[model samples]
Target: METITNRTLNLHEAWFWHEEEDRLRCRLCAHNCLIAPDRSGICRVRKNIDGKLYSLNYGRLIAAHLDPIEKKPFNHFLPGTQSFSIATPGCNLACDWCQNWQISQADEVGSLTRIPEVDPKKVVQAALEFNAASIAYTYTEPVVFYEFARDTALLAREAGLKNIFVTNGLITPEANADLVTWLDAANVDIKAFDQDVYRKYMHGSLEPVLETCKALKAAGIWLEITTLLVPGVNDDPLQLQNLAQFIANDLGTDTPWHISRYYPQYKFDSPPTSLKGIEKAEHLARMAGLRYVYPGNTASSTQTVCPSCGKLLVDRDGYRTVLNELDDGRCPRCNTEIAGNWA
Candidate 1:
C-alpha cells in the first residue's frame, strides 16, 4: 500500500455548496447542514472557513484494506472479486449502533492528532497493485469524503477498475447524480423502514435513503440493499415486511436484500440479533417477491439460488465462491437470467 508521511493535506472545496447569510449550505447529503464561519457541520468533517465549504477529511484515510466484494454483502454484483476498501474519518449520520464508530466518529479538532493522508492517484494505484477488481469507498460514509472518493473513482475508472460505494443511502439527489457518473455498484444500508426509528436511533430520516436507492437504480448502478436486524429495535415483522415490499416493488424484485445480524456496539446495548430473527427477515423478503435474499453475520450459507429453477447457481462459504450452475449470468438449469455483473 502507498503511504504518505504528511499528516494533513490542503482542504478540498466541497461539492453542492451555496452561499447563505455569508455562510455555506452544504447540500452533500440529506442533512443539508448550514455552517457558519469556522464551524463544522453535523458530520464534523465539513467545515465553513471564511464563507467557503471545505471537506476536512478529504484524502485523509483512517482505514484501508482489501476485502472480498461479498463482505460488502453484494450477492449479484461481481460475486467473487476482491475490492480495495478505504474510508475517511467522519460520517454524516450519528447512528448509536455504528459498527465502525471508532473511526467513523473520530474527532480530530479537540486533539492534536492527525490521520494518514493519501492522494487520489495513489489510491487508484494501490487498487491496481493489489489486483483488486474494484475500489470500495466503505467502512464509513463515503458521502462525507465526496471529493476524495469522486477523484479516486474517476482515476480508477480510467485504470480499468470498477468503483463501489458501501454507503448509508442518505446522500442528496444532486450529489448522488454526480457520484453515479463513475460509480459502478453500491451496497446501500436502508437501516429501517420506519421514519421514527430512523430519527430516534440513526439521527436521520428514511425518505432520503429510499430516494437514494431509486436514484442509483435509475442511474444504472448495480445496487444491493442491506438492513441490520437489531434485536427489538428494527426487527419488528411489520417493519421488515414494509421494507421488503419497498425493495421488491420499487427497487425491483431482482435487487439483492441482505438481512445482516446486528451486534451490540457503541451506544446500542440491545442483545445481538437472533438467528431466528435473521431467518424470519429473510423469509419475509422472499415472500415480498424479492428474488435474492441472504442472511449475513450468521452461520447460514450465502448461496445464490435461481428463483425460477430452485437450483443453486453460486455457492458461497464466507467469501469463497464456487459457481456451480451459472452460465455466464444465467441459471444453467432453467436458463433464467440472474441480475448481476457476473462476467
Candidate 2:
C-alpha cells in the first residue's frame, strides 16, 4: 500500500446528509452542522465541496493496531479475543480531555494531512491475518469515519468477523439506526452525566449520547458503558445515581458499567481520580441496581460474576483472561445467560 501524507480533494460522497438551499446539513452526529460551500462539518472530516458533502477521512488510516478486546475495555463483548482497531483523523465531538487528540482532533477541515488510504477490503484482510475476532472502529469517534467503517464492516462480517465501536456515543439516531446492523458490539464512553459538563467540556450534549446507548441496546447490539470518573467533576453521588439508574431502567441492569479512573491529561489539569473515589462510584452504581460494575485505569480485578448465583464467570489480569468459567455464554453455576457477544 502507498501512503499519501496530504490529500487536497475528496471524491467519496458522504451519506446521511441533505442539501439545503446553499449549505448541507450533516445528520451523522448530533451536531447537525450546516456546511457552506467548501466548508466542513464540526467533525472536520466531512467537507462540502462544490455542493456535495464528501467524507475527507474515509479509508485514511491515521492509526491501526492489533489490540486485545479488553483493551477496548469491552469486558463482556468478546473476552480473550483480539480486535483489529483502526481510526482516521477527526471527531464530531470536541472533547478537551481527549486522550487521542493528536489523531482525533484535526488541525484543518478542508485539507487532510492523513496517512495511507487503505481500502476497506485491506482492513478486513488485516484483521483476518491477525486472527482478530472483531474490527474495532476505535481510538476516536467512529461516527466521523462512518463511511470507512461501514464499508469495512460489511466486508469484515462477510469474512466471519465481528464489528464493534469504541465511541463517544454522540451519533445521531438516524446514523445509529443504520449502524446497529453493522456493529455487533460497542463500548461507549459516557464522558459525564451532567449536561452542563458536556457543553462546557466536551462541546456537545448529553441527551444524544444517552439516546445512542438505548438505541444500540434496543437493536440487539451488545452494549457496554464506560464513564471516566474525573474527581470533583462527574463524581457526585446524586449524578452517578441517576446515570446508573438510567442504565438499569433504560438500557438494563445487565449493561456492564466501567467506572474509569481519570488521570490528569491534555487540557484538563484536575487531580487524578482517587482509588477511594472510583470505589465509591462503583458502589453507587451497584446500589442503583446495576449488576455489573468495574473500576478502570487501576489495577483492579475486572471479573465477571453471575448476578444470580454469584459465580465467577471471567477472571482477568489487566487485558489478559486468566480463567473464563462460562459455558456457551451462560453461567455454569446458575445457568443464567449473559448479555454479550460470546460467540
Candidate 3:
C-alpha cells in the first residue's frame, strides 16, 4: 500500500462534537473528552483546533496485514476467510495490560516519527486487490480512528467487501449508530466483569462497555465477545461465571465467548494465564448455558458443534477449516440449525 505525505488533507472532522466555550467536547466515546484549543483528547488523537474537533490519526496506518478472520476470533462470522487488517495509533482506554501498547499508547510526538499515513481510498483499494472478504479496524482501538474507518468502510461496501472491528467496546451510541450501517461483524474484548478493575486498571468504566455490547447486538451487528484471562487478576471463578451468565442471558447463548490466555505486557507484571485456568473459564462459560465458548491464544480445538445434537459442524486448526457435518449451516445428522453466517 502507498503512503500519503500531505498531513493537512488527512485531517478529518470528528463525528460527535459540542462547543464548550473555547473547547470542544468529543462525544465519540464514553470518555466525552472536553478538549481545549490545540489540546487532544484522552485518546491523544482527537484534537481541538479553532473550536472544531478533528481526528489527528485519520487515514494514518500504523499496522496493516492480511489475517485470518478466525484470528479476529469471530468463530461464527466468515469462518475461514482472510481479512485485511489495519490500525492507527492511539486508544481511548489506558489498559495496564495492553498487549499492543507500543502503537495504542503512541501520541503525537511518537506517532509523527514512527507511523506512516495511508489514505482511506488506498485502504479500500488494497483490500480489494488482496481479495480479502473483510476490512478489519484492529490492533488499536477503532473508536479513535472512527472517521477514517467509516470513510474506508463506505468505499469497501461499495466494492462488495465487509467491514469488521476488533475493538475495546468503548464507542458511544451515536458513533455506533453510524458504524452499524457498514460494519458486518466485531469481536469486542470485555476485559473484566468487575467495575473496580475497569476503573483502576483500564482507566474507564464497565457500564459503557457493556452498553456498547448491548447496543451493537441490538443494531444487528454480528457480535463476538473475548475475555483475556490473566492469572490472579480476572480469573476468579465467580467473575467468570457472572461474565458467562451475562452473555448467555443478554447477548444470547449463540454468542461466541473466547476466553483468551493473557501474557504479561506493558505495565502489567502478572503471570501468564495457565491452560488449566483457560479450561476452567471455558467450562464455566459452557455451564452458564453458552453454546459456543472457545479457549484462545493456545493450542486448542476451534470447532463449532451443534448445540442441540452435539454434532461437529466446522473443524478448525489455526486458519485451516474443514466442514464435517454442516449442510448449509444446519446439522446434517439432526437437522438442527446452527447460528452463524455460514454462506
Note the clash tally of each candidate. Answer: 0, 0, 0
Task: Compute the lDDT for candidate 3.
Answer: 0.87
TM-scores, all models, native as reference = 0.96, 0.95, 0.95
Off by over 4 Å in 1: 1-9, 110-113
Worst 10 residues of 1 by lDDT: 1-10
How would you encode candidate 2's per-residue C-alpha lDDT over 181-264 as one tens digit per residue?
888999998888899999998899999999999899989999999999987778889999999999999999999999998887
- lDDT of candidate 1? 0.87
Tens digit per residue, CA lDDT, model 1, 1-343: 2221123446678889899987889899999988888788998888887678878888888889999889987778777889999998888888999999998888846311366568999999989999999999999899999999999999999999999999999888989889899999999999989999999999999999999999999899999999999987788999999999899888999999989988889998888988988988988988899988988888767888888979988998877676656898888889999998997
What is the RMSD, in Å, between candidate 2 and the native fold over all Cα?
2.8
The RMSD of every model to the true structure, in order and in angstroms, is 3.4, 2.8, 3.0
User: Which pairs clash in model 3?
Assistant: none
Q: What's the best-to-worst order under lDDT?
A: 2, 1, 3
Clashing pairs in 2: none
Q: What is the descending TM-score order? A: 1, 2, 3
Q: Which regions of candidate 3 deviate over 4 angstroms?
A: 1-10, 113-116
